[model samples]
Target chain A: MKKVLIAGASLTKVGDHWNKSLLDLAVEAGSAALKDAGIAIPDQIVVGNMFSGFSSLQENLGAIIADSLMLQGTPALKVESSGASGAMACNVADSIIRSGQANSVLVIGVEKMRDMEPNDAVHAASLGESASFTQFFGISQTAMCALLTHLYMQEFEISRDELSVFPVIAHKNAVPAEHAQFRKAITITDVSRSMPVSDPLRLLDCAPVGDGAAAVVLCSENGQTKNAEAEISASAASTDSLNFFQRDDMFDFTATRRALAKALAFAGLSIKDIDFAEINDSYSSVAALSVEALGFSKRGEGVRDAKEGKFDLNGKIPISTFGGLKGRGNPIGATGVYQIVEAYRQLTGTAGANQVKNAKTGLLHNMGGIDSSAAVHILRRVG
Target chain B: MSIAYWRERNRYYRILGSKCKECSAEFFPPVYKCRKCNSEKLAEQEMPKEGKVMAYTLSRDIITGFEDQEPMIIGLIELQNGVKMVAQIADASADQLAVGDKVKAVFRRVSVNGEAGQIFYGYKFVKIDK
Candidate 1:
């Protein structure tokens, strides 16, 4: 894979942005990234989002955001793969730069989820699942995850407190993360006792609904953007059964596992080379399954390992360094870009308190709809 | 029924799925290409109604249209012929459900468009007792 450089990166704090529209958040993050890169305009623009038509009552985000940024006539488009939209957009940007079609490409991942009514947001998010089969029955994504959560705990013989550890670690990590939505540290009891969205899966176990945007500017090996902080070594994505229950091994995060394997192979690196990871913890079970899929812990032991402090900032193979989807807040599609921006900060030594020691390599695992689709990218610091 | 559900009435009511001719593999929510043998030769098959509850959840965070069905119990069921599906676990409360409990399909109203609109009917699972 060509070493596409991350010349600039920026993000709006993940939380309720009552005063901003969808385009406002996109332009805010997009302009900051271009300014950081000292570029007047990118050769191409790519926006990653999910359910904008439902949340913002707006579509054609590509044209609208390009015009808003005053970069009309520039080639622009949008890519959506549910929650993996951001990483998938980045993957597209990397391919564009490597293909020599564009010298520089700007990728903006934005979502306006907080503006809608609570149930409407749930409905919008539910669109990520199979409409006729899953969503048609009124089982929201949270409900879908909850069904899996029950099986996971029961089959693995994991106690409630053990399953609650992933959120606990996420909250603790978010305490020092300035851009995180929830900065308050929490305990296992807090997670276990949180209001149940679906039985056995509490509110804290699920990622909070919020609004956010993140952007990154990618320049090719010899592109004019000279402010290269980190290089994207590999980008890989894979798909699984859209219905989680349909999969042969429901606990196996096939997409995440396959994507990570493909990404590591493409980068000529191994799991050992990854210093930290930014995995989608949309639910605690998803987080645990993803960690296990990434080979950080053995099967059915991801939560237990997390409970033992293995995924902490100072511990082995730290994950969700910036609170992840849980503590950092999940603006649906924007969460993946948030992971990339946070990883860029860690690699560039800009991560003040959430920084991992000697973090030379990082992995971003973004999944949509219960690991139905997954995108994994491995980033390494520039020399 | 809405036009969309009207079109898929057979699939909804009969559990119509795909069965690959080459590999003898069956799937719910039918696949275009057979995952087992990559066979495009497939036939529509009705899935077995008898199954066990692989998992279940009492869901409170439902989508807007389902406000009337607050806190619904949904189950992940594995049909007898070795196919998995998600169906509402009707006629049973959360306390009565358990993993590996036998269940069978029952026809029921799954969703309603509104007061004067369409009523989408489909299969719902009921416990087959201990």
Candidate 2:
């Protein structure tokens, strides 16, 4: 397989894009990426979207993006893996380049969730749940996560203050997030006092409904790989049961653990080797639990570490420096690629305000379909 | 809804599921497709209403329709049949919840979707008497 590199990347500020269509955002980011790489539109394009049925009621993303860009018949393909659709798109593009199927591939992940009411968007998002088990019972994703948070607290002797720190830190760091969806800084008290969505998950702890898009360019390393800034070192994905009922460990993210472990092993590194990380923090407690499952902190110790300022910008190990899904906003399909783009920015010293000091190595973790699918990648600065 | 489960809705509709007759893989809402073996053979099996709390959380802030309820408890329970599912925690404050505690499902108000103008109702779990 050929070595692949991220040649160029771009993104629209994640928030309510009421005036923008999916194609509009995709074209904007796609053009910006090409400009960044100093290249014209390539021979092929790959568009990744999670909820096309709800976003535009149109499933033909490839043709839509290509038509919008006026590059009809450019051999476009659409890919989806629930919310991780973007990252999965990246994996597909990388594989295509590495396998000699394409010289260059343009990947765009976009979602227009604000087009519908918040509840409808959430209901569409929860479509990933098993229709047989979860849908019949009507389980909200927040409630599902809240149940796990409650169990995690019980198993770890954790307190609300500990769990509250995650959202606090996420909001605090969002100050540097110029275009983040929710830029207001919050405190642990704010999180605790925020209105509850599901039990134990205050409104402040959850990511707001958002709309945006992110893009990246990939090519083989040999023939003019679009001026690489960072190398796609390793990407790994794993799956668990779609229904939460079949899992053994309610608090432990089995899929994340396996995916991260495999990715790190492939990269010949460990959590300590990572200078910074961008995790899927759809909820603050979920962020804490993700770090715990990644073995950054022992089980039940994540909240404690969080409470003690361990994940702050200047802390020993900072996470979600972009405010994460909590303060940055969760834009469904674009989230995973957004996280990767953030890591790329930090490693390249292009992240103006939120750049981690001397960040040579970074990691990105994104899960889709209620922990049923997870993807992890270790990125390195390659100049 | 099963005719039997619907008749028992006032108390709490605890739907039971069984494994595919050919594959032996269990499902919660009961299904025709055996996820494991893809066998098109299965049977309906009612789950024991009694179970232990597996995990839970206390939500503080409201989204849209739930603006009044500041904090609500949600939990997942493990039944004797080995099925796990999420339900709202009733008859107990957020402070009283803990993992592994015994609980049972009951009919309760679920949520307001903001469109239907109807109060969606479903089974929620309550702490069992010690």
Candidate 3:
């Protein structure tokens, strides 16, 4: 099998880009990434997005973005797996390269969230859930996660303060991250007392809605491998029940656990071998469950371990190296690509203050819905 | 939204779901195939109306069409038939709800699409007095 290498990566600062359209953000990041890769045009282009049609009233994103980038003739398309869209794009690009079909591929993940009203945005986000079952009842995704958090707390006897630690750590790391949305550091007390969006999930506990774009240039192993900062060692994805309540164990994220295990096995590594991880921290409870699913902590002990600083930058296995979804701002479809870009920065020694010292191998976990679909990628620095 | 809600009127009105004839396993929201046995032989069965709150949340940030219904209590209820589901907890305050509180499903208005649009109705749970 031909090895796939991440030739270059770029990201726009994640926030409410009211002035810029979705196409503008994609062009900015895509052009920068292409420039970074020293390639004028790639063999193919893949766009990862969730709700442009619903939020921006724009569809046919693939050709639109391709034409905007001045690569009109390129074979381009969009991949939508809700929040994991970005990572799924990368996974498809990897397959294209490995299949000996395309030597180079440009993967772009972008989301336009702030353009819609808050309630509308919430409705758009809920499109990822089971529309007939979950959304028809007027329950938002946050409400589902809140119920999950409540169950987790009840089952494990975890305190609100302990769960608050995840967001605090995210904000702390975001303080030094330039492209992060909320760079201001927050404390556990602030998270605990923050106005509740859904009971047990305070405002700070959830990833803020924002607009952003991230792009990565991938090429088959050859000349690109010489300059590549990280090699795509492994890529895998898995799925579970669309509705969270249908699962036998509500707290168990079987998709994430399965994806991680498969990706790690492909890379011939264990969870302990992971230097850092970019787990999906869409919600504080989601973060805890993800950590536990990845085997970083014992079952029902993810929050406890997080409170003990096990997931800090210098802890046993650091996570959310670049503020994660919480502080970095979750641009939905763009978030998975953001994780990959951040990993590239860390491996290439460009992550400045947020860099984990001597970090070599990193795991990127991106999920859609409530861990309904998960994409796990393992990247190792290959100088 | 109205059409979709209308399609599932039976499920919403009477808690109708699918039960696997092969294994006798039941599910809410209906499944095409049995999850446990992977059998396509399934039948429409009405789910139990009463259940206990496995988990609950009072959500202030709701989706569109639910703007007027802020701070809504939503619960994960486990029915007596051993099927769990998400439903809005109605006529109950935060102080009145707990993890183990028994509740029964009642048909209620879910949301009003627009000023003069269709009023969608669904099952909402209310705390059952001991």
Candidate 4:
């Protein structure tokens, strides 16, 4: 397989884009990517979308996006793995380039979640649950995470003060982004004051529903016609049981651990070798769990690391320099790709205000449908 | 009252999943097809009415069809049948709950679509009172 490099990337400010249709966002982001790469068109295109069928009541995204860009008949397709659809699309694009099937490919991830009412969106997302299992019992995603947070507390004796540290850091990091949704830095006291969404989880603790799109251009070494941000150092993905019940443990994500391990191994590095990271923070409790699972600290001690400012931009290893899904907004399918874009910007020194100091290697971790599927990628600076 | 086959079988108690004889994959609300191996051979199985609370949460922003049930405690419980299921946490405040705590099942009205609309009923878990 040939080595693949990211030629260009682009995105729109993530928020309520009610006036824009699904195809509009795709074209906007897709155009920005082509301009960034200095390429008019790619040999093939892949789009990542999770809920256009229900939220917008539309389908045939491959055709819609391709037609809008005036790149018709360029061999287009759509990739979906629930929330991780963006990263999944990137993975497919990379594979195509490495296999000599396509010299260059355009991978775009977009989700228009904020267009619908809050409850309507929640119900639509809940369809990811097993119809005969969790959905039949009427369980929603917030409740599912709240349940996991409660379990983690019971097992580790986690303190509310501990869970309080993540949002504090996230809001602070996101404040200067200018494009972030919740840009105001928060305090532990504020977290406690927010209304409870679920026991042990407050309204502020959950990621907000937002709309956004991100795009990446991947090409083989031979196809590089312009300077780009970075190269695909390594990437690994794994799957797990969709329902949380089948897993032997709630706090532990076997897929995440395995994928990270494989990724680190492929990159010929370890956790300590990573200069920064972007982990899935669909909920505050998840941020606390992922830092520990990624070997930043012990399982129960992730909260301690956050409290000490270990994950801040200037600390030992910064995480989510883009405010993450918590403060930046969770745009479902577009989230994972957005994280990679942030890392790429940081490594290339393109991040205006949120850039880490002389960063080299960065890690990206995303979980799809609770813990059912996971994708981890390692990026390096080559520019 | 007329109901779906799965709902009809669960009217007397909480719904349980049975694994297919041709494929040993268990399902909740019982199913005729095997999720794996796709075999018609199946066996009837009852879900344990009592289990340990594995995890839980309380949702404040309620959905449209479940506005009245706002701030509800939802949980994952491990049944004696070696399966885990998500259900509502009934009969207790958020503070009284913990992981691994014993809980029993009870039928309860989950939500009402409208003032005159159909009332949704399902099994909810309550702490086992000493």
| Predicted complexes: DockQ each | 0.82, 0.34, 0.83, 0.51
Segments of candidate 3 deviating more than 4 angstroms: A223-226
Q: Using lDDT, rank the candidates from best to worst.
A: 3, 1, 4, 2
Docking class of 3: high
* Every model: Cα RMSD to truth: 1.4, 4.3, 1.3, 3.3
lDDT of model 3 at position A29: 98
lDDT scores in order: 0.91, 0.76, 0.91, 0.80
Worst 10 residues of 1 chain B by lDDT: B1-10
Q: What is the DockQ of candidate 4?
A: 0.51
* Angstrom error at residue A294, model 1: 0.4
Of the two candidates 1 and 3, the one with more favorable DockQ, higher being better, is: 3
In terms of lDDT, the poorest run of 10 residues in model 3 chain A is: A221-230
Off by over 4 Å in 1: none
So what's the TM-score on candidate 3? 0.98
TM-score head-to-head 2 vs 4, winner: 4
lDDT by residue (tens digit), candidate 2, A58-163: 7888987888877787899888888778777887787788778887788888888888776567566776775434444455567677766666676677777677
lDDT of 4: 0.80
Please state the error at residue A56 of candidate 4 in Å.
Answer: 0.9
> Distance from true position, residue A36, model 1, in Å?
0.9
Best by DockQ: 3
lDDT by residue (tens digit), candidate 1, A1-383: 45699989999999999999999999999999999888888999999999899888899999999999999999999999999999999999999998989988989999999889988999888888988987778888888889888888888998988989999889989999999999999999999999988988999999999999999999987775575879899999999988877678989999999999999999999899889999889899889999999999999999888978899999998999989999999998888889989999999999999999999999999998889889999999988
Worst 10 residues of 2 chain A by lDDT: A130-139
